[model samples]
Target: MKAVIINTSTDSELVSADVVELSNEFNTFAQKTAESILAMGLTVAKAKRLSASDFETFCKLIRYESDSSAIRKLEQIGKRYDALHRHVDKLPSAWTTIYRLCTLDDSAIDASAASGALNPTIKGSDLIALCGAAKSSRGAKNAKSTTARAPADSAVPNGTDMVVRFTTTIDETQIVTLRRVCKLLREVDAEIALSNKLDAVLNQAVEMKEAA
Candidate 1:
């Protein structure tokens, strides 16, 4: 990990003397996931980790660009242009992470349909809609639809699981790669966040100095 220090007194923009690169966030990522994965008594191979890109890629794989027709299908309503291109503010929507995690690309999306260790049937869209707006106004009007095959699973339009299954096959290498990718992504994200905050503070200090 590396860090940077900003010198407010000079025209020089970034003062690197005090900078520190943080490698521990990755460790934190490992720690958090380790706690969860290990608590379940599951194997803690390197493949269990996830990269941010991996997450994003998986998300992109499962997510569909919302159009009017798709929105209508989700909302279970007639085609209404007003329902197009809405936002869902959620961490891990049920339609993707939860759905994929449990079903691993199966036909059993509904909790009622399967008996597994993970029952993540909560509607991600429902939760996202509630974040900053009223449900009736924010969310797609129709019931949530499975936009694409959940992540790792194939498009089994009809299978035992609704989406993907926990039994989904991921080799040891993939799991380790996932863990490393996620850990690095988290570190990068945190560094970016910290950099932004530091920039803001430096700018504020500069402004105050000028005012003085």
Candidate 2:
């Protein structure tokens, strides 16, 4: 008679293997869902048949109801799809990174692609840094005009502090980008506050004069 062999693996070991398999399956499903959503959003935007209200209603019917801001970003990505399609395979899986890519002009996008910065393996933070670098380069090009207008724009009445306040909503991606900007401003000794509230002390003129 053939000997019966007992399973050597413990129950915990079997469970661990199942967990890893489940995680991989979940990740695959999530990636596919993200791709599908983007494709649907692009189609809707390209069609241009839906009004703002109509889009919201459609989203409800599809159970894809996202906030207006997020919907807007998705639409923007769709609008820029022509310039982006070539790099689709290399683009990061995260929709946030794709949105950030939309923020860049075609030329910058091309440059980033040429530099291999748009690799699928690139992190969202790395993409943000690339966007920041592109923005800084553009800012440098316009620095002279910006500096020329700064004095009048920043003037304040004597013996009184000037505080400008405004409110707007931002997403997680924007928050990360803002934090990076705040860090750079701090490094330049710019008087800026970053918390639940943001306050700018308008010390740019001082910094410019000092630099000159």
Off by over 4 Å in 2: 1-38, 144-212
Compose the digit string of candidate 1's lDDT tens values, residues 1-212: 23244334544333222111112222232332212222111211111233433323222222323233322232221111112111112113222232222212122122222333222334555434333233343245333444434655555555634554345688999999999999999999999999999999999999999999
TM per candidate comes to: 0.26, 0.49
List all candidate RMSDs to the true structure.
27.2, 20.9
Model 2 lDDT per residue over 77-150, tens place: 77887777767767777777788888788988888888888787888889889999999987887764543433
Cα misplacement distance, residue 27 of candidate 1 (Å): 66
lDDT of 1: 0.35
| Each prediction's number of clashing residue pairs | 37, 0
Evaluate residue 168 in candidate 2 and report its C-alpha lDDT on the 0 to 100 scale: 91
lDDT of 1 at 175: 97
Which ranges of candidate 1 are over 4 A from the true structure?
1-167
